[model samples]
Structures are given as C-alpha cells and as structure tokens.
Target: MSSPEHDHVATDLLAALAMGDDPAELGLDADARDHLASCPSCTDEVAALRETLELIAAGGGTTLTPPPPSVWEAVKAEIDRPAGAPAAAPAPVTSLASRRRGVPTWLATVAATVALAAGVGLGAWVVQPDEKDDATPQAQVLGEAPLASLDAAAEDRGAAVVRRADDHLVLHVEASDLGGPDGTREVWLINVDGKRMVSLGLLPVGEAGDFDFPERLLDQGYRIVDISFEPDDGNPVHSGTSLARGEIA
Candidate 1:
C-alpha cells in the first residue's frame, strides 16, 4: 500500500540502507528510488540488510547500536502494516521485530537494531572485551625455543615463538616430523657470531611459520633459530643443511 508519507520515506530509506549508507547518493526519495527500483521485495530487503551488516562486521570484538526513536517508530509501524497485521509490540528493540514475518519491515527494524543493540545473536555475534578495553595491551612473550634435532640421529622436534605484536617483531615457527633432505625448507636468523645470516622466508607446507623480524634483529645478534635444507639449486646460501635449531631463549 505504501502511504504514511510513503512509509516515512521508506523508513528513512531503510535507515540509510542500514548504515553502510548511500541512500542512493543521499538524495533519497525519488519515490524511495522508484520503490527500490521496482521492488523485488525492496531488493531482497537491501540484500538482507547487507547480509546482516556483513555478519556484524565479521564479529570482530563486536559493536553496533543504532535503533532507537522508538525503534524507528516500530519501523514505521512495521512498514505501514496491512498484509497480515498483528505485530505492534516491539519497541525497546528486541523480540526481533516481534518475531519476523514476510520479511522487509526495513529488515525487521534493522535486525532489531543490530540484534538488540549488540546484546548479540541472530546469525552471529560474539562480544566480551569491553571492561574498558581491559587496559588493552596483550601479546608479549618476547622469546621461547625448543626446536632440537640438528640430527644427532634425528628425533625431530620444534617450536620457536617470540611474540610482541603491535610493536611488531613476530617469528613463530613450528615443526614436528623433522623429516626432510630433498629441497626448499628455509628459515633462518643466525648470527650469534657464527658468521651472520637472515633468510626468514619459506617454511609453509605446514612446517608452520610466522616470520617478521627486524626490531634490529634482536639488537643485532640475531639469536640463532635456523631450519635449512634448500636444494632447488638457485642457492641463496645457508644450505649448511641444518634441519632444526633454536636459541631465542
């Protein structure tokens, strides 16, 4: 039917296309962009409210709020009710727009305004991390090691950590089967005076990896870490064939 002032300019252009904006270049109302371009159920309710705001932005630490003004006047009185009536209860936001129905009442009022203003759930939500950002800072560990097996009769083993994040540094590494000898495994750091080294690159075929280094390479001594094998013959050096080693401490 479309009339309470064209469903309040199509629920304020579906709340500016549910926040990721662009209510058709913000000019809005060309009859709600010609009924959202001749309505295919308002373009599948603007692609299910932009896939539920991209699953609440891939739920990374969660945050979403907008849905007040009496939940956009209960989404413009559930888009000027008419189809099958009975649904006017939702206002403090949840009750997922009074338990959905034939969809598009501006996508159950912006998915009950971002699932009850982020109290979560309705496709996915995750939360927990707020207590004033719990004073933020994490990832520190600056050193660790274990990677044995420089083959005194091979028993294999691995690990090499060295965190620090957001101030960079990284250098994870991992290994277990120790098995190798035919080509390309590389990853190094050397230079605890054993004649300098750097390579930190190819280990990934599940030998596990992380590498970032250069906080002045652990203050220029590069504390060991090795893991060579390289035999594609393009030789970038360091093929002193070590299979594992560690030192980070």
Candidate 2:
C-alpha cells in the first residue's frame, strides 16, 4: 500500500498534469512514475484529467480570442484617469461577536451552504474503494434525480442510480459545464433530511462514468445527490462549495 505522503505527491502531480503542466519540468522522480504506473486508480484519474484538458482546449480556442487594440486603449484610459478625493480612513476592526451580529440572515444561509459543500468534498475522496469490484454487470435504473445548479455560474448536471442483481449500486453522472483544472468534482449521496451523507467518488469532466455505490447508503436513506468542487487540501472533508445537487427518487 502507498503511504499517505506518497499519495499526496501523486495527487499533486496529477493536478499539475491536468492543468497542462509539462511533465519533464515537474521533476518527477522514478518512484513517482512507478507509483503512477502501478496504481490503477491514479492512472485512471490521470487519463480522465487529460481528457478534460483536451476538451477544454478544443472548445476554448475560438471562444477566448484576444481583445482588439481598441479595447486595450480604453483600459489604459481608465487607468490614467485623474485621482478622486482622498479615501476615508479604514474602519476599525470589529470583534467576532459584532461581526456575527452584523451578518444578514440570507448571507448567513449562503455561508452555511458553502461550509456544508466544503465539508462533504473533503470527506469524499478518502474512502475511494479499490478497482477490483469492476465486474461490469447489467445495470438497471433504480432511481434518478435532475441535478440543479447551486450557483449562477454552474451548468446543468444530472445523475442516475442503478442497481445490479448482485445488489451493487452504480452511479452515473453527467455534467454540461466543466470545473477548474486545479480542482476536482466529487459526487455525494445526502439523506433527504440533510443530516447524513456519503461520498460516491470523483466525477469525470465533460463525460459520463459509473462508480461503485455503497449499498448501505440506500438503507440509511441517503438519496440526495450532490457534486462539489474540491481542492487538493490533503484533508478528507468536503469543501463547502456545491456546483449542482438533486434528490434521487
């Protein structure tokens, strides 16, 4: 088994590769390459990340054309504008108590949602099971839910939960918009009551893939599916930022 430190290094390298970093310049040692070659999960993750990068490159070419010279001139003009009146002195620092008291109810709700997403993302990646369970079975759709975008920037997403004759559960996910290359998108199963939850696994960008689902989740009534952005924080907890979510019927 690989040590935690080794796994962290591998994840870092994978993140760099996903962001189109040059492998030669990354200075990967022999042990790191060996681990990548030997670990199926890491290898699959690298392939998925590379595929996402390619898709992004292909779609981004014409959409991200550089601005014309006139745009740059306009920007320069704004920057050269005359200074206005002197700014007021900075406000004194407030106590934690005062800050909490000043927060609006809606802002507090948003903060709570962000915290929940972060916690779920952090906890999901640590429990990834080995790939030995990949005995592809004829999956039957047990239930599904239409994932709703949690923010205006998020694109449409969807998920389906299927069950095999052997009682194995498989989760199929599809996302219309891609996430940042440095971060990963993870799937979770949350209970309808919103108290209990479990991580399914990382979701591939711009493609659909099936993952091994814990049967116990259904027994425990974890039917709400969520996808959230997770950074490589090396902490096994959610990041409290959800992109999309839905309830599985």
Candidate 3:
C-alpha cells in the first residue's frame, strides 16, 4: 500500500520506535498501517527496530551526546591548517619493483582473491549469532581494544614509525610536524573506510592517550598512518606532502 513515497515517513516512524514511542502514538493513520500489515519488508524492519529499542532500554537508553570539548578544539584546529604544509610520505622501496615485476597478473589475482575469501571466512566465525544469543550482555558487546603508545613514543622527531601495539593497523599523528602560527595539532585515527578518518583526537605534543577505535573497523584495509602540518589553508585532505610518516610495521 505504501510506495516509495512513504519511505521518509516510515523511517521517521521507525526512529521514534527506537526511542520507545508506541506504534499507536506514531499517528500513522490508515495507509501506513495497511502497508505495515501487508508488506513483509516493512514488518521485518519494524521487528528489527523493536529489538533495537529493547536493547537501548536495557542498554541505558539512547542519547546522541556531542563529543567532549577537547575533540571539538582538535577538529577546529585541524580544519584551520594551511596548504602545501604536509610532511613527505616515506620513500618507496626500490626493491619493491624488483620483487613484483615478474609476477603474472593471473597469479596475482588468484592470490588476492584467495586472501580475501580467507579473511571473510575468519570474520563470519567471530560475529555473535544474535543480540540475545549470549546469556550475558558482555558476550554480545564488542571487546574494548587498546592500541600501543606509538603516539607518545616518537614525539617531536624528524620522522618516526608510529605503530599501534595492537595488531590492527591505525594511526598516531604528531602536531610538532604540523606547526602553525596558532600552534600544532596532531591526531591518531583509524580508517572508518573510504568515507572518513575516525580521529583519535589531537595527540598531545608530548603526551599519550587511549584513542580507542570501534571493533567493527578492526578488519578493514588500512596502512600508512599520515601526519600533516597545518599552514592555514582550510583544506581537509593531505597537503600533497606529509610532515611525519610511519609504516604499519
């Protein structure tokens, strides 16, 4: 009964459900109700939302609290960096070509495909079956991870490797390299994928912090944690050069 026209309305209604609004309180009227009753697609969604709502209730309710003041300050500082003020990326390995040149394309493709399949299989084995699959909420919740203090280990150096003690590859930035008239700003972040970098917050010019990342991003592909110096250009991407750099190793 509801065509794509009802999409936005349905989504808003579902979001309210997550906040514990009863369906009757949604004021959906007749068409939305007819659609929900007849459409397996919409019914399934409602079920999922109800489950999520229950989880939120038992999970301390839900709130979209803004990040702390320090995070905003760091964000504003990073946005204020200048152009052409990036540190250089590490030099390419001269021997890399020698190792990769003679490899056949077909063979390389096969190897890559196999590697991807293995990784997927490994991940499926780890996801919990259902929210209620475990007797304790802890079993359903992801474990907290701590990356090593590579952030503080190499502060104020010309160039140093910033490796996470944790096996998952992530970043540790240095503000000393990203000098500015206002001062310096550095951050360690995990690649939340191609969209954006999850800032570990501004790194202390000389101190270290927890900088934890969500476990969901643990297996995504990433390497080459970059550090850039802000020159007041108002740019977001790297400045075509890196001020400080390190490999995943």
Q: Which prediction has the highest TM-score against the true structure?
A: 2
Q: Model 2 over residues 69-132: C-alpha lDDT tens digits?
A: 5444433444454577322231121112221332334323322222222221111222222333
C-alpha displacement of 1 in model 1, angstroms? 6.1
Residue 103 in candidate 3 has what lDDT? 32
Looking at model 2, report the run of 10 residues with the lowest lDDT sum. Answer: 90-99
Better-scoring candidate (TM-score), 1 or 2: 2
Clash count per candidate = 0, 14, 13
TM-score of every candidate relative to the true structure: 0.30, 0.41, 0.25
Per-residue CA lDDT of model 3 for 1-249, tens digit only, reads 325334322333434443455545566556555655676645554565455445545653343233445444443443454655532221111111122332334333322222222221111112223344444432222222222323455444333333334333233332233443453344433353545454444556563333445444445533334444444566654444334444343
Error of 3 at 190 (Å): 7.3
Better of 1 and 3 by TM-score: 1
Encode model 1's per-residue lDDT on 39-133: one tens digit a residue.
56445555655666666668755565444465456556665767776655422310112222344454545455443333222233233333445
lDDT of candidate 2?
0.56
Model 3 worst lDDT run, 10 consecutive residues: 119-128
